[model samples]
Target: MQPEIQLSNSTTQLESTQNKVLRNTYMMLGLTMIPTVIGAYMGLNINFAFMAQHPILSLLGMLAVMFGMFMGIAANRNNALGVVLLLGVTFLLGLMLGPILQAALHFNNGAQLIGMAAGGTGAIFLTLSTIATVTKKDFSFLGKFLMVGLVMLILASLANAFFQVPVASLAISAIAIMLFAGYLLYDVSQIVHGGETNYVMATLAIYLDIYNIFVNLLNLLMALSGDRD
Candidate 1:
């Protein structure tokens, strides 16, 4: 009976901890949208002549942004500044997505396709997140696999970007959607199971997953739906 009582208490504490982590992750994830939108607007409206002239600049910019993201994660345990920096990093990512948006906007059905992609991606994310919470299964093992897949995908994308391979582009978009969907599930499960305690880090991971899904979905939709007139 004493052992049973202690087991019940431990279960209750775990549940309480899970609740806090989930709530904080969701709240921080919602807050990240504000800066993302602001950065997108800035990207769409603002033009950088230097960036236009030097494609390498974009590559270097990506490297710098990734460095900042790693730093933010490393600092998340000690300070609130990590949260602020994470938001700023997301804003930078939004800016990077500007050119893609610019290209999509040129299509006759661009706006409609973008809206559909956004809705579809959101629905998938919600479904995956719900599954993670309901099942409470640990998906942390996906981390290494996801990293390897992403690296391969990035290399393929860079090659296709220069080579202009239509099939490659389609493959990347499809793989990206699936990969990020898995990521959504894994990240949410971490929060629900008390594996991820820091809201800032949780938000950053989930935000990147969602953002990649949207980008890939939008690209896929554009390739399929966009009419070249």
Candidate 2:
């Protein structure tokens, strides 16, 4: 009976910690959007002609910057600096959306499509996160599968960058939407299952999932339903 009581108490404490992490992750996730919106607005007004002129160099540079920031965030995950770095990376990502957002806004119903994409992304996140939290199922099994799919997707995207095939681009976006949705489930489940104990890191993972989903979903929507003016 003593051992049983001890195990029960430990389980309760673990659950409490998990719940706190999940709650903090969600709160920080919400806070991240403010900087993202500001960055996007700035991006809209800025000129990216240099990027258009030197596409490959621009892509590589952006990737390098993002990778560096990711490392910084990970290294600082145990402190407030981690949260700051996370927000900084998110703002950079938002600024990087300039080209796509500009393209989407070129269509006759661009604003409407953007709204739909945002709404859909929000809905997907809410549903998947709710399922993960409520079910309390360990989705760690998805880790490997998602990583494989992501690698394949990246390879395909890089290949398409050279080929410049519109259909292939659309296909990549579609696949990306599914892949990141899975990531959202896996990420949120990790928080719920105590697999991710740090709210900063957990928020970063979930934020990236949501960000990718929105970007890909918006790409698909702009491709499929955009009415050029």
Candidate topping TM-score: 2
Give the distance in Å from residue 12's predicted Cα in candidate 2 to where it truly belongs: 0.5
Tell me the lDDT of model 2 at 24.
94
Instruction: For candidate 1, write residues 1-229 as lDDT tens digits.
Output: 9999999999999899888878988888888888888888788876756666765656667787788676766677458778778878888887877877877888988778878988998899889998888877788888789889889887887777567779788999999999888888888888887778777778888998999999999999888889768
lDDT at 96, model 1: 72
Which residue runs of candidate 1 sit more than 4 Å off their true CA positions? 48-57
Q: TM per model?
A: 0.91, 0.98
Task: Give a tens-digit lDDT track for model 2, residues 66-120.
Answer: 9999999989999889888999988998898888888889999988988999999
Alpha carbon RMSD to native, model 2: 0.9
- Candidate 1 similarity to native, TM-score: 0.91
Candidate-wise lDDT, in order: 0.83, 0.91
